[model samples]
Every structure is written in structure tokens, then in C-alpha cells.
Target: MKSPINLEVVHKVIDVFRAQYKNRDLAAKTEKILFNLAATGHRVSEQNFRAIVGHIRNHDMMSPWFIVSNVNTGYWITKDEKELSAYLDQELNRMSNQFDNVSNLHKRLRHGKTKGTGNQASLF
Candidate 1:
């Protein structure tokens, strides 16, 4: 599939993180990065930013980069062993919680505990 943002712009965003490597305090937030992109004449939305960043994190293999994002610290490139480990732990926890929620909903639906609301119909 084609990327939502241009390759050049993707590289630019990566470079922004790269420049802040190991500098946890310098992590840029999504809004700040989007603003920077807009200032540079790139028409990027928050969704586009998420899409490109998600792609880079999951698929980009040429660059040995790990983008660490946190609610408090924002986003930054990290090569530190400890920081990367923590990031992985955090992401895993988040994913686990998400899965748990989905599983709960599935169980509820299977047990017919929830009726369809409004115009929505139960798929089961």
C-alpha cells in the first residue's frame, strides 16, 4: 500500500526524531511535529502522522531506530538499551489491556449480555 505521507516527509519526520536520539527531554509531541510539517509546506494531518509513524515503527527495517513515545515524554528516537526495553514493556502492557477489553466485549456478545443499541444491530 502507498504511504499516506510523502517519503520525503516521512524521512524528515524521522530525522526530527533522529536528531533527538537519547535526549528524552527533547521528545516532540505529535501536534508539535505536525505543526513543523505544516510550517515546511507539508499538508499532514494527525491521522497521517499516526499512519506514517506506525508504519515506520512496524515496517521500516533499513534504519535501526526505535521511536519511544510516552504520554509524558512525547516521542523521541532511542537507541539506549534500557529505554528501548521500557518502551517495549509499556507497549506490550498497552496492547494487553486493549486485548483484554476486546475479549471482554466478545464474551459479553457471545453470552448475549448486551443488546444492540439505537440503530446498531448485533452481529452475532
Candidate 2:
């Protein structure tokens, strides 16, 4: 599928990091993580950023799987749908597991507290 943003520009952006610390092999991956800068002139104004995005949308060249994660630190724009799907699934599983773990711990603590503090003799 055709893409609106020239990948060369994107690669150049990556080159900035590669050049910074004299790292020879950064190994440019197939997926691109683009941090949405929006507008460089104003820190908060999203006008120019919206314009650029609008133009790209008008072109309608982006793939169906194209998405930008509004994650903290930077925006991740990836064309690799398969990779993104797997990554999201992994994150979902991890987060759910963590929540379950916390919930279980809380329940255990609460149960133990109730057992120790409750007046069992009165019930008997």
C-alpha cells in the first residue's frame, strides 16, 4: 500500500539518534514510531500538526492498520498491523494479569484480617 509520509524523512529523523552517540548499528526496524510534534513554532498549538495530518488523511494513502498510539513520552505510528496486534495482545494480557494479581493479594489480606480480628467465639 502507498504511504503519504515519505519514509526517507522518517529515516532521517531516526538518523538523528544514530548520529548522537556514534552508534553504528541502530538497525532501523520495519515499523516506525513517530512522535507527533504537531507544530514546532508553538509548543501547545496543534494547528500545523492538524494541517499536516489533514493533508495525509485527504490523500487517504495510509493503510487500514495505520495507527498512532497516544502514549506518554512519544507517539508511536506503526504500519505493521501484525506486530501492533501482537504487541497490544501482549500488553492486554500483562495488564490483566497484574490487575488480577493485585486483586488477589488484596482479597487475601482482607480475608486474613477478618479471620484474625472477627469475634469467632460469638458466632460459635
Q: Candidate 2 residues 3-101, lDDT tens each?
A: 455444433433332343121122222122123221222221233334444444455434442323323322333546675675578668888887766
RMSD of 2: 14.7
Clash totals, every prediction:
0, 0
Best by lDDT: 1
The 10-residue segment with the lowest total lDDT in model 1: 115-124
Model 2 bad stretches (over 4 Å): 1-39, 42-75, 109-124
RMSD of each: 5.6, 14.7
Quantify all predictions' global Cα lDDT against the true fold.
0.73, 0.40
lDDT of 2 at 73: 25
Q: Candidate 2, 66: how far from true, in Å?
A: 4.9
Best-fitting candidate, measured by TM-score? 1
